[model samples]
Target: MGHQQNALHVKDLNVAVKTPKGMLPLVQNLHLELKPGKILGLAGESGSGKTVTCMALLQLLNPKTMSVKGSIQLHGRELTDLNQKKMRSVLGRDIGFIMQNPMNAFTPVYTIGNQFVETIRSHTVLTKKQAVDLAITSMEKMNLPEPSKLMKKYPFQLSGGMLQRVMIAISMCLRPSVVIADEPTTALDVTNQLQVLRELDRLRTECGTSILLISHDLGVISELADDVAVMRNGRIIETADVFQLFDHPKQEYTKQLLQARPALLLNDQLKRRVI
Candidate 1:
């Protein structure tokens, strides 16, 4: 797709942290393109800079210690040079972020409704009641139960799955063009993982929102992504269409990573036993 059609694009992206001794590169020469209404799966092992890439796109890192270079374009607008005030306008309004930890996404002291309303109001001119209605609507779309009742519940009161669903709801409340989901199902059970994935898929279908889905789960990536990029040691080692990557991965690292998944390993053992 061309630049006009791309919802999010990254080119020559690099991120590094300043250490006492020297700068340590965490990500290098990374590139990604997410088309509207499509999901791009970014998968890798832990400490592979998957989260750093996402954070860098929104300039969430500490500027004092972390340095981000290259270009991050959203809807064809360059974000790398935007000031904090302008970047704020782009963050929740143009690009929503769903963090891995559901508990951290919400405040323990505030009710879910309060947080949702605050987020909506900050990004829009809506009154509190209008924002609440938006929250309830988004929550319903996410398949969350008792939208009105959920508003009254605090983050601590809900289960992890419920909180995750709420987080997705909150992130999509503004109907942003792009969403960066960092291991959205990391803490959920298998059933809840499926639920969260389906909800994300539904958002793409319903709102035409592009997604950068960061996860270590190849199974999760295969289930939801149209395109997949494999990261290793702070670099994008391989990228391909989801089917091609799974069926005929070009890189040895990608192959090993796929085989390392618990479900895939179990399947391999089962096939060996059957033979």
Candidate 2:
């Protein structure tokens, strides 16, 4: 895709953690590009460096213990060399992140409303009332019940699904250009998973935010991604448009992954004929 159409681009990304013996690479020479208003599914096994790659892309990894190399460009602007202060400005404002666990995104001590207000204020010059309004509006968009009421509760008070939805609301509230959702549905049950996925889909449709959706479940990837990449042993084995990747995967690892998810494969088969 052309530079203007791409929301985020990666080239030769490498991430390694320090070990007593030597540097242990977790992600190697990874390349990915997400187009504006498109969803890119990044699928891999549990330890396949999917999360590591996401963290690296966002510059979230600790420099002291982990090392990252290569280019991460968000809208054609290089992010690898930015200082912490500048990166912080870019992080939530330009690039939103929806972590796997909602609690990881919020503080235990603060009320949900407090956190949301702070997040909104940090990026925009909106007043507290305006920020609260935006928060409630975002919650309403997610079909969250009684947005005002949920705001008073702590992170621990809400159910896992509710927390997930709340985090989604917060992440998308800023209207960031790109969103990196790491294992967003992993902790939710089937019902909540569908709800969360729907919210993500709505974000892309309504706001035109490009998404990098990382997940171990091929089923979830199949449901949301426009394009898909299969990763293993710190490398992407194959990538293609969603239907092509599911129906005629190029790599053995990708094939095995699809075979293991029999239900998803059946679903994809049905989808293929419809297309």
Candidate 3:
């Protein structure tokens, strides 16, 4: 067992949406652990509460619509009940997120360079020129084709793939100890996805960051995860090492999920052939 130190620990998490009808539980008894320098993938289809769970960890869920009950510890520090200011300190500094929708990553009026500089300066005492240089450098590291030109334009000026790379650069810039990536490659082509995946692997090797990867695609999990959790109806039906979960899934639900995955059509077809 790799048994690296856990950067994030979640226990018995319960989450509910407070609709006019009543408190409707969306997730129940959800638990997970993410170790530093390792990737933990949460695989599930829509309505599985994958996104909700990540929001809860950052304590970013809309207060009026939802409530979360759980013990979340980040680097041994309890994060379940933190004030907004403290939470902000932790968010950009210790934990960063690669949101599913990169289009919403930038303000319409602000140049990407301006926003990137602001984001950097918010977390550190770096000067405007310094932040701008850092932002361009980070974008270059994320493999953007023309970081200088792209930074001069607004969010609307870039393509979806370009925006995704920019978002990745922003999220991983500070080398946050924990990173939560939700469908990060949803908009990218296969080649770009592979590049991003390779960069993500480099992040772990370089920073020892713990990554919580949420994707509907099993292929992403297979590529990046050190551990795998199969989630259904907001619950984890199976948790195991990446290889074990893929090779020998124990739960019926997990098996069904893998079989249903469009990416595994070959395996699903072969299983029927053998049977």
lDDT of each: 0.90, 0.90, 0.85
State the lDDT of candidate 2 residue by residue for 201-274, as single tens digits: 87888899999999998988888899998999999989999999988998989989987763654345434532
Candidate 2 residue-wise lDDT at 188: 88
Candidate with the larger TM-score of 2 and 3: 2
Off by over 4 Å in 2: 262-275
Superposed model 3: Cα runs more than 4 Å off: 1-4, 264-275
Worst 10 residues of 1 by lDDT: 266-275
Candidate 1: stretches off by over 4 Å:
1-4, 264-275
lDDT of 1: 0.90
Candidate 1 lDDT, 25-80, residue by residue in tens: 99999999998889999999999999999899989999999999999999889998
Error of 1 at 248 (Å): 0.8
